[model samples]
Target: MSDETNNEGLNEAPWRATILTLYPDMFPGPLGTSLAGRALENGLWSLDILHIRDFAEGKHRNVDDTPAGGGAGMVLRPDVVGRAIDAATGEGDMRPRILLSPRGKSLTQEKVRSLKEAGGAILLCGRFEGVDQRVIDGRNLEEISIGDYILSGGELGAMVLMDAVVRLLPGVMGKVASGEDESFESGLLEYPHYTRPTIWEGHEIPEILASGHHGKIAQWRHEQAVALTKERRPDLYEAWEAEE
Candidate 1:
């Protein structure tokens, strides 16, 4: 059975996310708790969980089968996943259909912003070995990976993706500029941040921070962000340099 968890009094045309997965209960888990959760409750966005098993045929209601050509794990059937995709998206839905996979392009801030602007997304979580290649291509699903490592399933990746996108939705964050200087927003890792207790463990907050000069503080932050990115992510640093 499908579960619709949209709150009452929703904003007209709020961002929508429809997740297709065997583990329907996994959704809105973390997405239902923090800033994303608050936004969900305020009707800034909506979530619909579609159980892939609901589309399976046969008395056993099996959705996966032994991988063809011999493999250790079962592969999600194209027919079953296809039916689920079709059910989630009707004619002219226009929202991007995404399949979370390890081999897909790496997820990035730019991609997250694009998704936010796209209005919504339909995420399909692959379990076991993965979904059949035919359905991935046939359904026009764009695969995305959160990192180089692998997870047991795509549910976590889907949540990660949703969290990144939801926080960018207008009115979700306390301040619009709050996201402006974050890591990757400017193609660099964010600079270090400090709070209360100016002097801690014999180490005082950087003098430049307390100088009361906004211009110098901005300069210091940018330099720190550049140095940090260059040291840890030379690839990003080079790309950022090239763009400049």
Candidate 2:
């Protein structure tokens, strides 16, 4: 049996997301498929895909132009991107507006947690060199980066950010605890997970797992997760220390 939108399930909270991109069709096949798709298909969320080119001037539907001052890559026209943003969030109320740029502030779990408000969100996916500076400044949008590296387009970055934040919204996950214990949830890497076999080809399950001491096992996992995070991402460890 499949839950292809049951009437009772429609009663589940459905969040709304509006993505402003030149390539709306790029999405949704597999990229944001995990939690994002389930949220959309089951009516847990509604995704509004807006094509920036649709709002363009001519038959060419141009959305970008060469950057002024002579840059290697073109800069997306400010007016086009800004108009798309406005359409997505609407002029009614203020929402957390995000401009995806490689040079922007690095995305983080805490940042994702901050946008958990039930209000709608608008994501601007820039292409070419980047969106025009005038657009970013004029909109006063918060800039976010998935990592230090650069990608050809902002659509992938937007999807990553959207998936992360949307899952945090209330009622997205079928299981309430799904997002609560994942890696980075507690500023720590996730502890290892085990499944049914108990014993694999060359290894046996950890003895403590079979000890039945639930409290002790839980404490052990937390300590291990913290240690792993400390080893892998020193930045997270430093932030944890600052908080402590």
Candidate 3:
């Protein structure tokens, strides 16, 4: 069940990602484009797609079965998922094992940063009703949810998580500062962005942004970010205020 291949270059222990999912072909889809793609090509990171069904039992290669307590949908078999996890990550692997599920703790920028620091992760893409709870506990997997809503499967969520983490990897993005000023990095949504033409549809870019004063510009951005966060997410604004 290991279709694990490292696109590693010499001496570079790139951030590794081993995704356990039924849809193995869905991997590196968008991640193989843009900054993440370039990083992968540069050997700044590696991807290993572990097809969960590869470890399925029986002639059908069945990975999921009816829900244990009479659910409307089937649940992924713990044994199958367990086998996939084991095959992807061998002994002594220090990477954290994660399961993508709506029931999990909401994923955040802070968590992504932690995973980036870890240099890798083992992501389990749950399908059907969900993976068996017992296996989740036994494997010590960290469950994560992308949002409050549900998706058809966890494949997209895993990709999203990886995309966020990969962009922060050293040398992945054009500028390290890009990640720092982003939304949630400073407990506030990002400030507005403006570009040349300066006047978009008769709306001028903020006057302060055009002032050419670095200190003033920085102050303006901070103020804008604070105001925006307070208006849109008062909870975050409160937390940010508490820290100040």
Residue pairs whose backbone atoms clash in candidate 3: none
lDDT of 1 by residue, 183-243 (tens): 9999999999987899999999999999999999999999999999999999999999999
lDDT measured at residue 7 in model 3 versus the true structure, 0 to 100: 37
Better of 1 and 2 by lDDT: 1
- Tens digits of per-residue lDDT for model 3 on 52-131? 88898787988888986685989888899888888988879989999999999999999999999998999999897888
Q: At residue 211, what lDDT does model 1 achieve? A: 95
- In candidate 3, which residue ranges exceed 4 Å CA deviation? 1-12
lDDT of 1 at 45: 89
Clashes of 3: 0
Identify the superior model by lDDT, candidate 2 or candidate 3.
3
Q: How many residue pairs clash in each candidate?
A: 0, 0, 0
**Candidate 3 — worst ten consecutive residues by lDDT sum?**
1-10
What is the alpha-carbon RMSD of candidate 2 to the true structure? Answer: 3.1
User: TM-score: which is higher, 2 or 3?
Assistant: 3
Task: Supply the TM-score for candidate 3.
Answer: 0.93
- Deviating ranges (above 4 Å) for candidate 1: 1-12
TM-score of 2: 0.88
lDDT of 2 by residue, 120-174 (tens): 6677887888888888889888889999898988888987877787676555565
Lowest lDDT block of 10, candidate 1 = 1-10
Model number with the top lDDT: 1
